[model samples]
Target: MSHKDTIAAIATPPGNGGVGIVRISGGQLESVARGLLGRDLPQPRIAQYSSFIDAHNNTIDTGLALYFPAPHSFTGENILELQAHGGAVILGLLLERALQLGCRQARAGEFSERAFLNGKLDLVQAEAIADLISSSSARGARAAQRSLSGVFSARVNALVAEITSIRVFVEAAIDFPEEEIDFLADSDIQQRLQQVIDDIETLIVEAHQGRLLRDGIELAIVGRPNAGKSSLLNALAGDELAIVTDIPGTTRDVVRQQILIDGLPVFVADTAGLRESEDVIEAEGVRRALQIQEKADLVLLVLDASTETPENLPVIPDPKRTIIVWNKQDLVAGEMPLAITKGLDSVIISIHNTSGLDVLKQKIRQHAGLNEASEGVFSARARHLDALHRSEKLCRHGLAQLQDFSAPELLAEDLRQAQQVLAEITGQFSSDDLLGEIFSSFCIGK
Candidate 1:
C-alpha cells in the first residue's frame, strides 16, 4: 500500500491569507525534506522553523516545517507539512521546489485516496472527508463529521457481519443437500435472516434521511397565474427573490432560491403559473414548471384563497408528494370552503402577513424527513442508498427462496450477492471505475 514516489500539493485554498500549507506524502519524504530544507528534517511530528532552500541553494521562504514518519500520518505514509505565508506566488514557488525535489503534484483527492488504500480509512470515511469540506449547513457538517468518525461505516460493517454469519449458515446447509430443508426451516435461522433484513431496511431509511441532509431537497412551487407562488418563495427565502406582479404570467421562467429549514437545505423553485397560455414564452415556462414538478421531492400547489378554487388545477402526479397551499388567507373574511379544505392535505397561509408560514415550514421539514433527532444521523450519498437498496432486495429475495424450500443453493447465492452489494458501500467490493468517478468529483488538494 506504500507509494514509491512522493506527491505534493498546496493544501490551503487558492487565495492569500495569513498562512498556507504545502502538504507532501510518500516514501521519499525524508529525502525530499532534506532537499527542500537543506538541513536535517524536523523531528517526527514536531514543527521547526526553517528556511526553505531551492535547487541553487537560494532561500525560497521561511516557515514552520513539520514532519510525520510513515504509519502515523494522514495517508499512513511519511508526511511533511510546510506552513508558510499565504501568498499565491509563495505557495507556487514552494510547490515547484518540491516537484524539483522528486515529488509531483498530488491529484484531486489523492491524499484521501491514499488513506483509503493504506487502510487508514474506509471508502465511506474517505467520502465523508470530502462531504465535510463541502457541507453547506452546520447540521450537514456535523452529520458528515459523524460519518467521518465511522458512525455510518460501523453500521454498515455490523450489517455485513450479520450477512456473513447468515451466508455461512446457508452455505453450510447447501453442502448437505439432504438436511438443507430442515436447516432452512430452523426457527433460529429464519429469525436471524428476518432480523438482518429488517436491520438493512432500517439502515436504508436512516441513510435516506442522511442523504437529504447531504444533498438537500427540491421543492417546486406550482399553481395558476397570480396564486402567490412568487410571494411564497419570497417568504420562505426571507427576501424578495422573485418579482410579484398582479399581472398574470409576470414570471415566465423558473426562479430558484436556496433556503435552509431547520438546518436542512431546501432548493425552492418558483416557476411560471401552470396555465394554458398563447404566449410562446409563457407556454414554455408552464412546460418547465410541470417538468420540475415531475422531478421535485415535493410540490407546493399554491391556491389563491381569495378566489374560488380553480376547476383546472394542475394535476398532481403524486398526492402524497404534493402540499396543497391556500395562499391569500388574509383576504378571506369567513372560513375556507369545506369542500376545498376538507379531506385534503392542505395548509392555509397569507404571504403578505406571513400567517401560517411556520406551519408550512414545518410541513416542508416533515416532508424532507428531518427532525431534531437528526443530529446523530450520518451523511450519505445516492450511491450508498442504491447499494443498500440492492442489498435489501437481494436479502428479501433470499428469504423468499427459503420460503419456497425448493432451492437452498439459490438462497445461498442470493445471500452471497447481498453481502457483496453491501460490501461495496465500504469499498471492500468496489470497482476501480467507481472509485475513480467518486474521487474525481472532489476538489483538488482535498
Candidate 2:
C-alpha cells in the first residue's frame, strides 16, 4: 500500500540545535544516494560515515548516512537518514540541496500515513501517537502510551472476533433447511448475542473516559462583574492573565486561560458578569457569557462568599455539571466557612486569601471523572465512540429481527455490518477517504 513519492523533511524542530536530521523515503533510494554520495551507496540497514556534496561536487557537510532497504523499512520503502549539525541556516541549506537532487518536501502527516499503510501501525496506533504528543495530564500520557502499545486495538480486535463468530453461526443455521430447532429460539444464540452486548457496554464506558483524556475539560467562570471572577482565573493560572479590578465591568469579554491542575488541562474561561446592564457593550458581553456556558464541561457559578447565595446567580440554566464557588471570602471573614444548607452543594473560597480553592479543585477533579480514571482507562477518540454507537444500534436491531422475524439472513447481515463498524476502531475496515482524513491530522515527518 506504500506510495512511490520520494518524500523528504527536516526531522527535528525548526530551530538551531545540537544536531538536525534530514529523513528521506522512496522507491529510488539508490539513485538519490549515488547522486548525493558521489559513489555507490552502502547496502541497506547499515550506517556509513559519508560527506554530503552539492551538485557541483563540492563538500557540504559530513554526517552518518543510514539506508534502510524496501519492505523492511518504515513505510515499507527504501529509507535514508542524514545526521547534520543543528543550525537553521545549515538545515535550510541541506533541505534546499536535497530538493535540487530530486526529493520533494513531505506534507503534514505523510510519514505516519506511510507507516499505517505499511502495517507498522494501525489507525488507532497512529492516532495514539498524536495523543501522546499533545497529552496534558500524566494520566492522559499513560493512557495514550497504552493505546500506542496496542492495548486499545487488542480490545477492538477481540470484539470483532466475537462478532465474526456469531455471524458465522447465524449464517450456518440459515444454510441448513428444515432443522427442528429454530436459530432464534435456541438458548445458545440468545446467550451469545447478550454476551456481545455486554462487551460493547463495557468498552463504551472505558472509551468515554479515554475521550476526556484527549479532549480535556472545558470550564466556564460566571458571576457578577466584581465577584473575583478574574482573580480566580489569575490565581489558578499562576499568572496575572486576567485584569483584576474592583471596578465592575472591568472585563467585558471572555478571558480564556489554559491551566494544568495536577497535570490535567482545564481550559478556564472567565466570562462577563451575568447581570442587567444599561451599557450596550455590557449587554453584549453578558449575551456572550450565556453562549459559552452552554458548552462548558463544568460551570463555576461564582458568588460573593461574604453574603451572596445561589439566588445571586444569573438566570442561566443549571448545567449537567456545575461547581458553585463562593468567592471573595478574604473581605468577609478572612476564612471560608462552608454551609451546606445554603441551597447549592457548592464550595466556598477566597481568591485573594486562597482559601477553599482546594475544595474547588477537588470538585473539578470529581466532575471530570479523573477521580475514577486511575485504572482501566484507555485512550479513545470521538470517531471510535461513534463507530461503537453505530454498531450498538445495529446489534439492537438485529436482536429484534432475530426474535420477531426469525430471519437468519437479516441477523447475519446486521452482524456483518456490525463487524465492519467495530473494525473501523482498529482500522481493519478503513476506506481511502477515512485514511486520508485520519493521516491528514498529523504533522509532517511524524
**What TM-score, over all chains together, does every model reach?**
0.96, 0.92
For candidate 2, the 10 contiguous residues with the lowest summed lDDT are 333-342
What are the Cα lDDT values of the candidates?
A: 0.88, 0.82
Query: What is the C-alpha lDDT profile of model 2 across 36-150, one tens digit per residue?
Result: 7777767676778888887888877888888888778777777888888888776777777777778888887788888887898898998998889879888889889889999
Tell me how many residue pairs clash in candidate 1.
0
What would you estimate as the lDDT of candidate 1? Answer: 0.88
The alpha-carbon deviation from the true structure for residue 58 of candidate 1, after best TM-score superposition, in angstroms, is 2.9
